[model samples]
Target: MIKFELKDLEVFYGDFQALKGIDMKIPANEITAFIGPSGCGKTTFLKCLNRMNDLVEGCRVYGQVTLDGEDIYNDYDVNLLRKRVGMVFQKPLPFKMSIYDNIAFGPRTHGIRSKSALDEIVEQSLTQATLWDEVKDRLNMDALSFSGGQQQRICIARALAVRPEVLLMDEPTSALDPISTGKIEEVVMELKKKYSIVIVTHNMQQAVRISDKTAFFLLGEVIEFGDTEKLFSVPKDKRTEEYITGRFG
Candidate 1:
């Protein structure tokens, strides 16, 4: 099943085109990583998946992007669509509320009122995020009290609480230590069974380690895309080989 389809997708910040007629199909319950050098529109293309770029002034998108075979850009509620397609940023931005409240915020806003129901959802989300045992007894504490990695996991739990079908992560492990990065990689691997994950990462090693499919982007164009093993070991594109072998970024 195709979870997302981008057809002739182009994005612009005013007159400057960031993406140039890109097309791709994201499969259901798998992890797809976007990798490229800086300013290559990897993040720009990721933002269009959930319409996150619309918040930027004068940013416009031209092309068809569909989620679950539905045109997300046409006659659809952005708020509801976001709930179905959750996003995690480069940094973890937890609410000022307690740890439990942080995870419960989305469910509450989406009309889950009962305490028992919220508790169940919170537990499930935290477990899925791989932060349950670490903070299980301290649910009422401040989210700020945790370390950077823990905070990121809390943010992931918050995204999961809403039961999103697609999870979009932009450099999710960029700021954490190696151990934290490993933990996140483990959680991401686990998440692919239940949710389709699309990630943008500059860390080629992490991308190779975690993703089943990889898309190589260069200068706002998709240079190549294939299974992780084939793309990393025997790239069809010379540019991909050069980028992967550190000959040139």
Candidate 2:
């Protein structure tokens, strides 16, 4: 099933065109990686998934971006859109509160008021992000006490607390050590059974390792997209081959 479908999508930051007329389909229950040089609109397009770009001043999006066959930009409530499509960023940004509070924040915002209900969500989200065992006994401790990687997982748990259908990760492991990166990758692989995932990564090798499908972007356009193995072995576009082979970004 298709989770997200984009047609003739364009994004403009003031007078500068970030994403040109583009089209793509993101399948449900799979991981899709967007890879390219910096400023190639990989992150920009990721933001469009949940209308995060809407917060940017003078930012405008054109064309169609649908979630589960419904146009999210046309008539959906912005806040609810975010609840359905959660995001995890490059750096781990945990709220100053305890781990339990960080996970409970989303459920509370959505009107889930029962303490037991919040407790279940907190535990489940942390478990889903693969951080429960490490911090189960320290749920009341400040979230900032953990290392960078643990903090990222906490952010992921926070995102999952809202029961988002799609998870958008923008270089989520870029700041972590090798071991931490591996852990995040494993968690993401396990998550594909339930949530559609779109990841933006400058690390092509990481993309090849985890993503079921890969999309190569350049100058705000998708140059090629296909199964990870086939696309890497025999990319249809010269630019894709160049980027993958380290010939150029």
lDDT of 1 at 155: 97
| Model 2 steric clash pairs | none
Model 1: lDDT to the true structure = 0.94
How far out, in Å, is residue 163 in model 1?
0.3
Per-candidate Cα RMSD to the true structure, in Å, reads 0.7, 0.7
Task: Give the Cα RMSD of candidate 2.
Answer: 0.7
Q: What lDDT is reached at residue 105 by model 1? A: 96
Clash numbers, per candidate: 0, 0
Q: To one decimal, what is the Cα RMSD in angstroms of model 1 from the true structure?
A: 0.7
65-105 per-residue lDDT for model 1 (tens digits): 99988999999899899999999999988999899999999
Q: TM-score of model 1 relative to the true fold?
A: 0.99
> What are the models' TM-scores?
0.99, 0.99
